[model samples]
Every structure is written in C-alpha cells, then in structure tokens.
Target: MIVTRFAPSPNGPLHLGHAYAAVVAHDLAYERGGAFRLRIEDIDGARSRPEFVEEFFQDLEWLGLSWDGEAAFQSHRLARYAGAGERLKAMGLLYPCRCTRAEIAAAATEIGPDGPIYPGTCRHRAVAPEGAAWRLDVTAAMNRTGPLEWLDEGAGPQAATPQIFGDVVLLRKDLPASYHLAATLDDAADGITLVTRGMDLFRSSHVHRLLQALLDLPVPVWHHHGLLVEPDGRKLAKRRGSPSLADRRRAGEGGLAIADALRAQRFPAGISLSQALNGTP
Candidate 1:
C-alpha cells in the first residue's frame, strides 16, 4: 500500500503553502486507497512550541484533512537519530565541524543548492571542538555507495548528485538530528512509499537519496509539486510573515471552500503557483 505524509514544523502556524502541500499528500494517498500520516518536525527545541503543535492539528482538522494514525513527533525519536549518526560515524562517513555560519559565508567560494556550499575547513580536523556539529563526508559516501538514482513522479528517473551540496550536516550541535537525517529515517520508519512536497525542495531529494543508500533505508518515490508563490514569485514562508490558516479560519472563512479553491488551482489574488525549476523561480 502507498503511504504519504505531511511533515510540518510547529515553529509557526500553518500557511496557505503548507495547506496546499498537505492537501496534495492527503489526496494522493486517499485517492489511491493508501494511508496518509502526519509527522511533527519539532526537533528544534528552542523554536518548537506546544501551542503551535496544537494549532497545527486544529488547522489540519479545519482544512478537512485526516491522517491514519496519531501524529509522530521528532522529539520522541532523538535516540533513533543519535543511533543513525553513530552508525555513520562508525563507518567513518561523518566528521565533526565547528565552523559558524558567518565564518563559512566569509570563506565560501561557490554557492550550492542550499546557499553557500560549506568549505571543508574542519573536514580534516583531528580533534572535534566543543559543540561541534556532525557533517557527512559526501565525497567518501559517494565513493562507498557508487552511482545512485531515485524516481520522481513528475521528473521520472533522476541520478543522485549529492555532491552539489558539499558536505551536508547530519547532526547539529544543538539538536540530535538535522532535517536530512531525521526526515529520511522517519519516512522509512513510517513506511512511506511516496514523498509529496513542494518543488522548492526538489534538490533536497538528492541528499535524501544518498542518505538512504548509506543507512540502507527503503527508497520512496517523490512528487515535487508546484510551489505557492507571491506575485513577485517569492515562495510563501513563515519567516517572511505569510498569512496563517488560523487567521483565515478565525475570520469565519469556510475551510472546505478554501480547500476546494486550492484543489481547483484558484489561489487568492497576488498568489500563484510556480511549477518552474529552481532557476526560473
């Protein structure tokens, strides 16, 4: 059976972009007689709030979407993340890094998919500094895994090219796992067969594919759907202060109406769907 999930971080209330992504995942699974699941990505202890989590549940319920089981929380699976990191460390695929973001930015020469590609400053450090984050040795990992590929529902077969991101972080100094590690593990754990998310995250699938190869996790097909963007084409993000679903709900707007409009590709004025690849966006 196909399984899909809507994994959202509870750092803020759900926005229209999140609503669209959730609806896509929910519909894909339900229409095919599969299971839809929810996963709360609350691993960032400092930012994640219980009130926001409750609000997420309320928003999804208000949006007329339901999951098959109780939602999974990343906070409850810290040990599993730590264990995965340890396994990677044992394989000599992870290295500790102490470079701060500002330092990396100053030293970075080339830009990669997720911003400045991290320069391997601490890649060869013999001793790990205090509060060092763990980074995967992408070069060595690729050497071990050899050539890899993953399938996308829309793009079809894609050759995994994780090297583009340089050495990506697997475990953070402040958190047990980064999104790359936790999400890959959680998807496999939840038995997800299809990963439905926005196209903005399309490049992330390459890293996730490499992680699966290293961890021996089950591979799943991905669907990188169009992103909900502003009139200027900037993707709707909580950091930029996009309007939340809770706000609409509190205004006496009908949830089903909003969902139906979204399903029909009828977005609010100034909001449009962008299906183009990274460059065009």
Candidate 2:
C-alpha cells in the first residue's frame, strides 16, 4: 500500500503552495487506492496557534483534501520523539549542545539549505543532556551506516550526504524535538510508504535518510516535487504575505476547482509553477 502525507505547520493560513502540495499528495494516493494522511506539524511551540489548527482543517476541507484517520499533531507526540532521542543517545549517536543561533552564525564557514551548519562547538563538551538541545552525531551515524542512498520518484537515485549539514539538532532546548527527529520518527510510526513534499526540502531528506537508518526505522521512497513559484521565479511564502486559501474561500472559490487548476498547471495570476522541479532559473 502506498501511504503519503500532507504535513503542514499550522502557524499561518494555507497558501496556494500548500494547496498544491496537499492536492498532489491526495490525488496520488486517491488514484492509487492508497491512504493519504494529514499531519499537523505544530512542533514550533511558540508559533503554533489553536486558531490555526482549526483553520487548517477548514482550509484543507475547503480545498477538498480528506485525510485518513485522525490527524497526528507533533505537540502531542513529545514522548515518542524523546524515546527515539534517548535510544540514539544510548547508541552514542546523539549529544547535547548549548550553542545559540548567533554563536553558530559567527563560527559558521559553510551555509546550508536551512542555515549555518553547526561547527561542532559542543560535540566535545560534556554537557548534560537534560533540558539541553540534542544534536545527532552525523559522523558517527554515517560510520555505522556507510554509503547510504534513497530513491526519488522524480530525480531517480540520490546519495545521502548528511555531513554537509554537520550535526543536526534532534531535541531542541525549548521544544521537545526538532523537525528532523520529530518528522523522521513520526513518518516511520505512521507507516508511511512514500514521502512527498516540495523540492525546497530536498536537502533535508539527506539528513532524514540517515536518521531513519540510525533509528532502525522503515525506509520510504520520496518525491521532491517542484515548488510553486511566483511569475518572477520567487518562492511563495506566508511571510511575504502570499494570498491565503482563506481569503479565496471568502471570495467563493471552490477547493476542488483550485486543485484542478493546479493539476492542469494553471495558477492564480502573477504566480506559476516552476518547470524544473529540481532547480529553477
């Protein structure tokens, strides 16, 4: 059975990019007679809002995307993430770090897809794990599982190189778990067979593949689809005030209609989907 998910962080309204992702996953599963699950990635404790959670359901429904069973919220799965983190710690694959963003940026020489890769400032330090940020020892992890690779439906085979990002935080200091740990653990827990999301997250998959191996979890094929971009080739983001689906709902647009438009490669005025799913000019 092919199982896919449309996991969104409910910190803001669902924009067109989100709708494209949801519809793509939903249609792929629906056509294959598989399961399409919805996951609320509300691990960002400070930014996650109750109103947004309610709005998430409303927007997804409005866009005619139905998820299988109950939606999984990351906030409610802290213990599960902790258990996985502890297991990694016992395996000597994780350690605690106290470096803040400012400290990392100052020391960083190589910038990653997300930001500065940690320079291993705390890897040698004997910092107690409790209440401290935990980072995955990528060097040790890669040593255990040598020469890893994963399949991408669109791009074919990919070599997993997690060391490019150095040590990735698994357990956050403020939040219970970081995105890498929580997402990888939950994907296995949910029995997902296929992972589909924007190509913007393509690099993150490298780290996720390593985590899956280290945790002895199930592996899933991935499809890093092209991102929906503005006509000028800029990525659509909530922070830039992209028009949300809520506003479109108020204007009496149907979810299925928008989904159909997206499927047909048609988009709202002033924005369009990129041709190169891997990279755009």
Candidate 3:
C-alpha cells in the first residue's frame, strides 16, 4: 500500500499554503487507496509553541484531513535522529565545524534563494575545535554529486548540477536536530512511499535524497505542487494568518464550504473534498 505524510512545523498557524499541501497529501493517499500520516516537526523546540501545535491539529481536522496511525512529534524522537546522525558520522559523512552564522557568512561565496550556498571548507578537516557545529561532509559521501538528482510526480525526474547548500548543517552547536535530519528520519520511519509538498521545498529534496542514500533509507517519490499565491502574487507566510480553517470554524462554515472555497480557488478539475480525503469517487 502507498503511504504518504503531511509533516508541518508548529512554528505558526496553518495558512492557505499549508492547506494546499495537506489536501494534496490526503488526496493522493485516498486516490491510491493508501494511508495518510501526520507528523509534527517540532525540532525547533525554542520556537515551537504548544498553542501552535494544538492549532495545527484543529486546522487539519477542520479542513477535513485525516491520517492513519498515531501522530509523530519530532521533539520526542531526538534519540532516533541522533542515531541517524551517528550513523552518518560513522560513515565519515559528517564532521564537527565550529562556524557561527556570522562566520559562515564571511566564508560564503555563492548566495541564492535558499540563503548562503555552502562552500566546502570543512570537508577534509581532521579535527574540529570545541563548541563546533556538526555538518555533513558531502564530499566524503560515496556519491557526492556536485549537483543532485530527484524524482517528482507532476514534473517527473530532474537533476541540478550545482550544490544547493554546501555542507549543510545536520546538527547545531547545542546538538539540537535540524529539520533535514528529523525530516529524513521521520520519512523513513513512517515507511512513506510518496511525498507531496510545495515547490518551495523542491531543493531540499536533493539533500534529503542524499541523506537517504548515505543512511540507506528509502527515497520516496515526490510531487512539488505550486503554492497558493495571494492576489498580489505573493506566497503566504506563517505570520500572515490567512483565512485558515480555524477562522472558518469561528465563522460557522463547515468542512464542505471550506473545501468548496479551496476548490473555487484553482483546484484541479474533478477533485473534491471527499475525493481529497477518502477518494470516494
């Protein structure tokens, strides 16, 4: 059976962009007569609030999204993430780097949409100083492609020859698990067969796939959908607080109304809320 998951961080309220992602995952699972999973990516514990986490469930339910099995929270699975990091370390795929944001900025050469493009400075460094951050030694990996390859459902497979983020951070100075680590672990643990999310995360797939290869985790199929841009042609952010499911609930709108509104806003043909959830065609 095909399995997919909707993993969202509880750093803020769920906006239209989130709804689009959740709906896509839910609908894909239903269409394949498979399972949908939900995961709370609360790795950034300092910024993830309990209120935001609670609101996430409320919003997903209000928007008619459901999942199989228990909900997984990243904060509670630090050990698992740490284990993966250790495995990567054992493979000589990682090393400690004591570079702060300012320090990295100073060394940064190519900047792109995803912030600083990592320059491989710590690749062959024998030892790192104390209080250093952990980084993936991309070059040490057996298949370190300067550019990576990934498969997307809607757009098919594609490859980028240049590195997206150079020697990206896998672990912080305080040893907190970063999104890349936790997300990769959760995807493998959940046995997810497919991944569907916004195109904004399209680049992250290369890193994730590389990790999968390093750690021998299954690389799920991905579909990077377009975002629900606002009238001004701007994508929604957590701070914007668009007409979320919670807001609609307060306005006395039911699930169907919310679904209709979403569909009216350029949803693909023949896709209904029911189809999105249960695939009852």
Candidate 4:
C-alpha cells in the first residue's frame, strides 16, 4: 500500500501553500486507496508551540483534509532520530563542527534553496572546539547514491546523482536533529512510500535519498507541487498574513470559502513537467 505524509513545522500558522500541499497529498492517497499521515515537525522546541500545532489540525480540517491514525510529532521521537544519526556516524559519514553561524556565513558563496549554502569549512579542518554540531560526511554519502528515480506526480522524474547536493548537516549545534536527519529517519519509520510537498523542498530529496541508501531505507516516490505564490509573486509563508483557518473562521470566512480559494489557483496537472521534458512547454 502506498503511504504518504504531510509534515508541517508547528512554528507558525498553516497557510494556503500548506493547504495546497495537504489537499494534494490527501487527494493522491484517496485516489490510490492508500494512507495519508500527518506529522507535526516540531523538532525546534524553542519556536514550536502547542497553539500553532493545534491550529495546524484546525486548518487542515477547515480545508477538508483528513489523515489516518494518531499524528506523529518529531520532538517526541528524539531517540529514533539519534539512532539514525548514530548509524550514519558508525559508517564514518559524520563529523563534529564548531563553526558558528557568523563564521559559516562569512565563508558561504552559493545560496541553496534553504539559505546560505554550507561551505564545507569544517570538512577538512577539524578544529574540535567546544559547542560543535554534527555533520554528515557528504563525501562518504556520495558513494551511497545508488541509481534511483522518483516519478513525481507534479515535477515528473527526478534523477539522483552525486553532484546534485553537496555535504549536508544531519544535526545542528543547538538542535540534536537537523531537517534532513529528522525528516529522512521519520519518513522511514512511518513507512512512507510517497512524499508530496513543495518544489522548494524537491532539491533536498537527493540528500534524503542518499541518507536512505546509507541506512538501507526504502526510497519514496515524490511529488513537488507548485508553490502558492502571492499576488506580487512572492511565495506565501506563515510570516505573511496568509489568513490562517482560525483567523478566517473568526472573520466569517468558512471552510467552503477557504477550499474555493485554494481550488481556484492553477496547480500542476502533471502535464507541464512532462511537456518540459519533451521540449514542448
């Protein structure tokens, strides 16, 4: 059976982009007669809040999206994340780095989808200072990128290779689990056979796949939906006033209105990606 998930970080309110993602995943699972799981990615305890997480459920319900079983929270699964990280470390694919955020920013050049790309400043030099974060040895990870292709429902085929994404951090100085580590490990633990999220996260899938290879986990098919852009073309985020479901209901904009607004937006029908590959679109 195909299993997919909609994991949202509970640091902020759910927005239209989140609704689009949730609805898409829910629809796919419904069509395939599979399972859709909801996971609260609240690993960042400092910023994550119960109120925001509570809002997540309300928002999804308002948008008419439903999932099976009890929702999973990353914060409560540290032991599982640690075990996965330790497995990578045992394979000689992890190292500790004491570089500060400022130091990393000063050395970075390429800007990744997330932010300032890691300069691999600590890869060669092991200055083993106090307060260091653990990093996965991407050089070792590169060897594990086996031949795999994901038939993304929206993004079409995504081919994996070594040069796609460089060495990535599996854990941070202040945080025990980085996004890649927690997400990949949890994806396996949940038995997710499909991953549906935004295209912004699509690039990170390569690194996630590499981690799965190292840990001998099953790779899930992916579907990177188009982002919900604002009227000015900027991608919508929680920071902006993208009316949360609670706010909408308080303002008398019921679930039907929210659903209509989301459904009206032009989303991928899986034709464009195929067209682009065929040099048509």
Give each model a TM-score.
0.97, 0.94, 0.86, 0.86
Compare candidates 2 and 3 on TM-score and give the better one: 2
Candidate 3 lDDT score relative to the true structure: 0.73
TM-score top scorer: 1
Rank order (by TM-score, best first): 1, 2, 4, 3
Between candidates 1 and 3, which one is better according to TM-score? Answer: 1
Question: For model 4, which pairs clash?
Answer: 93-137
Q: Return whichever of 2 and 3 wins on lDDT.
A: 2
Structure candidate 3, residue pairs in collision? 98-132, 118-166, 147-161
Model 1: weakest 10-residue lDDT segment is 272-281
Cα lDDT of candidate 4 equals: 0.74
After TM-score superposition, the amount by which residue 29's alpha carbon in candidate 1 deviates from its true location, in angstroms, is 0.4
RMSD in angstroms, candidate 1? 1.4
- Candidates' lDDT values, in order? 0.92, 0.86, 0.73, 0.74
Superposition-based RMSD of candidate 3 using all C-alpha atoms, in angstroms:
5.8
Question: Candidate 3, which ten residues in sequence have the lowest lDDT sum?
Answer: 272-281
Candidate 2 lDDT, tens digit per residue, 1-281? Answer: 99999999978888999999988899888899999998999878779877888888998898778899999888888889889988998998888888789999999999876689889988876657566788888998999999899988888898999887889988888888888888898899888888988887787889999988888889999977778898778778899889999999989988889888988889878887764543311
Segments in model 1 whose C-alpha atoms lie over 4 Å from true places: 277-281
Model 2 scores worst on lDDT over the 10 consecutive residues at 272-281
Off by over 4 Å in 3: 142-149, 160-162, 264-281
Residues 75-164, candidate 1: write the lDDT tens digits.
899999999999999999999998989999999999998889999998888777899999999999999999999999998899999988
